[model samples]
Target: MIMVNRFSRLIGTLIDRAAALQHIASQCILCAAPGQKGLDLCLPCQLDLPALTQCCQQCALPLFDHKAYCGQCLLSTPAYQRVEAPWLYQPPIAQLISRFKYSRQYSIGKVLSNIAARRYASAYIDQKLPDLIVPIPLHWSRQTIRGFNQSEHLARYYSHHFNIPMKRFLKRCRPTAAQQMLTADQRRSNMKGAFQMCGDVAGKLVAVVDDVMTTGTTVSEASQCLLKAGATEVHIWCLARTE
Candidate 1:
């Protein structure tokens, strides 16, 4: 059943891209090599995608083993229940995020979300999929500046693939400092009271989606809000986690 659905999605994507491919048919995204059949990437560039096979089950850090939590996650603990990320924040994927988010190539959001949905389906079949997906919210000011919230786009992709629902469960209370510029302590403090749960997620399984997670502070704060709103658990599904 899952395989059929995935195959259907792949075919649909290919058909959807048929028109767009006319302009860039033989191009590899990462290395600028040639392309294969209909894939946007040549085999080499596609195969070379940086991935994290071994990581902490709870935190998604590139790790020595699943049993070994990263020292940071072990020390203070995080608010999210579990984490899953297919890629490490490196190379082509990292640059892809910049091009997508900072450059207004919103198409990247759909591409990354599709990749994440496929990966998540492959890895987690038996687990109960989340009852609802929540995008890590951006403050209106920042969203105004950026024009749109990338995470919201990514969350919608996952919601479509998983046949689950999506809700803007949390809202950014205000524009906190850009987390990239903050110290770990500062990151935590910056996000404090930055989000509020606006609707019921009580006793329901929730998955929070995002593009990249660095210190996990943003998702942690978001999860804290949902928990306070009575969510049973909050797993994180992100495109990449910085190692």
Candidate 2:
């Protein structure tokens, strides 16, 4: 029986490796062209991705000028110190995100995560890296329906690539209406007191990871919760930002 179990485990491992290689040998998700080199996207499609060239350092909204803060940030500051979103929420990228988030197309998600990870590594090479990465949590009910949290998957990729620890330090205490359906004020009100700390973050610098940032209310509320739980500082990291 012991030998049989060992043989089964080895077979399973080999099967998994073969599946991974097959996936890497597949074509691009966008253009259907070959030579992806392990990515689900082709080099041309990757280069054509809409990047956030001029954005506010605080909120990551696209800016017309070379300003650190946008007009909105000047009026009011967010709880998180800064946001780093490498791409704009635009076509092809938007479609990829939708497929990843709603349809559980994990290959698309992996492609997006790889781009974001590379951008992060280059941008933060000389800067202070966060001690921990905390993904924005979904309520249990929503997670049960979705089968996975897109944010957590993206965070996991970053953790693996950057050698940083990813922790589920916060929990969603209750379900809230989708942020896209609500007005900015309504979104802020809906997220209030929605998160509770799951672990101690005392004096630790944290980077909150998410797939997208729209009104910024969700991350703001989450940052406040982490700060209340004794986190020294909070930074926002997302794949895309909407203007």
- Give the candidate number with the greatest TM-score: 2
Q: Which stretches of candidate 1 lie over 4 Å from their true place?
A: 1-27, 31-39, 65-67
lDDT, each prediction: 0.84, 0.91
lDDT tens readout by residue for model 2, 135-196:
99999999999999999999999999989999999999999999899988899899999999
Q: How many backbone clashes does candidate 1 have?
A: 0
| TM-score, predicted candidate 1 vs. hidden true structure | 0.85
Per model, how many backbone clashes are there? Answer: 0, 0
Q: Write the per-residue lDDT of candidate 1 for residues 191-223, one digit (tens) a residue.
A: 989998888999899999888988898998898
Candidate 2 has its poorest 10 consecutive residues by lDDT at 33-42
Q: Give candidate 2's TM-score.
A: 0.89
